[model samples]
Target chain A: MTSQDLFAEISIQAEDFSLADEVALLEKDNLTDGAVVTFTGRVRNNNNGNSVTSLTLEHYPGMTEKSLAKIINQAKEQWQIGRVKVIHRIGELHIGEQIVFVGVTSKHRQDAFAANEFIMDYLKVKAPFWKKEQITEAGKTSENWLDAKTGDTDKAELWS
Target chain B: MIKIVFFAALREQLDCAELSLSADDVKTVNEVKQRLSDRNSQWRQTFSNASLLSAVNHDMVAGDHLVKSGDEVAFFPPVTGG
Candidate 1:
């Protein structure tokens, strides 16, 4: 990997990302990388049994990227990760649409897997992102912002 | 002056995203919440919610975190993302 690949790249956009392309970018020309792990989160048609029509992801402008970088940096400190790339989608999204992507490259499978999971676990609560679910039932449409689950906080705390 | 911002559901409930405050009026995150709560019943109810979270200069902090002029403070509900 080159010096440019030494740091993590974080993108907050409204456009969807290709998982193959993102993973390829992380592994491209990285001869030392022995393992790569990628995780994609997609919007589901139903959340908690409600028929979710769509999801609108909201994030704090400057702080969103900052928090992601912080999570990536934390992962680097704990594992021997090579390249990390995180892309999170915002704005409106329909059911089954992609919401977030996290890819990590490392010299071994354990490191890559652990780092990938770590970034995602922290992103759940540490990053300033929120999800609002649009539900339609019997032709009546309503929306509610999803609250952070206590389980997410517990998972993040376990990392420490 | 200090900058304060709200995000997500908190923004919708408070009907605000950002505001400016004189640093002299508040010295900590808790003080800012108290001042905001004094604005009206709606604000009081919103800020007083136990689940509300806050940050100073983009890092999560507790209510007692000290703040000063030029600081950026944010308030929001717990984040829900993956």
Candidate 2:
């Protein structure tokens, strides 16, 4: 099947990704797209002023990918999306690294915007991911793993 | 017997995930909660005065629903995961 006809969700062990490549895949075959919007969540080196050294992401194996695909399908059914690309990283990653990326393309700005927001909201609350941040201060390291916040649920409920 | 599980914050608060009790002990979901809360002060504090959620067979369920053996029952704070 054409990539655009199906949603793509993957957990990879490679060194990040090329947004250019991902966006290209959305527009790969034929030509019917008018607007393309993408959201990339990066691993910043600081959180509330703490110098983050590394981050570790964990997720439930088969279930995680299934949940993500379901979310993308829901978004596709809602909006006239041409293609959607969702890539999330698992395992340990350093600061200034890429954590997750979502790319959506549609024939109109409204479809692109709605689908992009829908994918992000579902990923935040439903995709079964946990992040542990390792912070460094004065050459000492401490790891702090925080649970998913309540604000994310509120954000997802807006579309529900 | 049915096994009830708690996850994330609820598990942290209850200090446990899976609990085993006889079919006769808990017929309704509410009865399960009451039995759990009666175990200790910790459970009472975690379940008695809180907005707890439950799942039967991994799907969300109400408090008064009946539970069957081998069913996976889960309790948690209103799901905050995404």
Candidate 3:
């Protein structure tokens, strides 16, 4: 496999992933990078004044991966980064569960940090995934679809 | 016929996952939406949502994007996941 193929990966799975594993895979002993940055997003217990019991993530199967690849490609164009790996989970996730992972390695910390943040900001607005919450209110249970936050859109726009 | 699909909350709201329409009757994604919206009041409301997003052949596109036979069109709400 080529460097890009081995270093970069985008996966959408219902199964959970290990950060240590992804970290090891990203670098793979190439040792050319001086800095590594990674970010992990998890399911929160509360949102919008409701206690969230679980979250269900949904995406258009084929398009989700393609969109993520497009985002990664954009990052590759904008930064001198080494390996990049992105993992996003779908299906039911209870509170405190890991939802997403983004890792980047670059020759310096600046590119690593900037590229990591850029991927996350754009992923929120550009990726196809949507979230629905199973929430509890007044001792009753209900489901609500989470709306895209305006702040996220604004944050992404800042990069452009 | 161009295949049309819905995802996430939009699919739940419409109670539809996928459907098809003759390409001869529509030119752009907007026209396909207009045709679908004409089915009833509920459809019209759903289609009228400004935040509604569309894609042709799995690539995100605008309402004016042209559609052709065998192209798969998808509609959904704005993304929220990271």
DockQ of each: 0.85, 0.22, 0.87
**Pairs of residues clashing in candidate 1:** none
Question: What would you estimate as the lDDT of candidate 3?
Answer: 0.91
Which portions of model 3 miss their true places by more than 4 Å? A1-6
What's the ranking of the predictions by TM-score, best on top? 3, 1, 2
> Which has the better TM-score: candidate 1, or candidate 2?
1
Q: What is the C-alpha local distance difference test score of each model?
A: 0.90, 0.75, 0.91
Q: State which candidate, 2 or 3, has the greater lDDT.
A: 3
Error of 2 at B71 (Å): 3.3
Per-model root-mean-square deviation over C-alphas:
1.3, 4.0, 1.3
RMSD of 3: 1.3
Per-residue lDDT over B1-82 for candidate 3, one digit per residue giving the tens place of the 0 to 100 score = 9999999889988999999999998999999999999999998999899999999877999999999999999999998897
Q: B1-82, model 1: which lDDT tens digit per residue?
A: 9999999899989889899989997988999999989999999988879989998998899989999999999999989977
iRMSD in angstroms, per model:
0.8, 3.9, 0.7
Q: Highest DockQ, which number?
A: 3
TM-score of chain B of 2: 0.90
Question: Can you give the lDDT of residue A116 in candidate 3?
Answer: 95
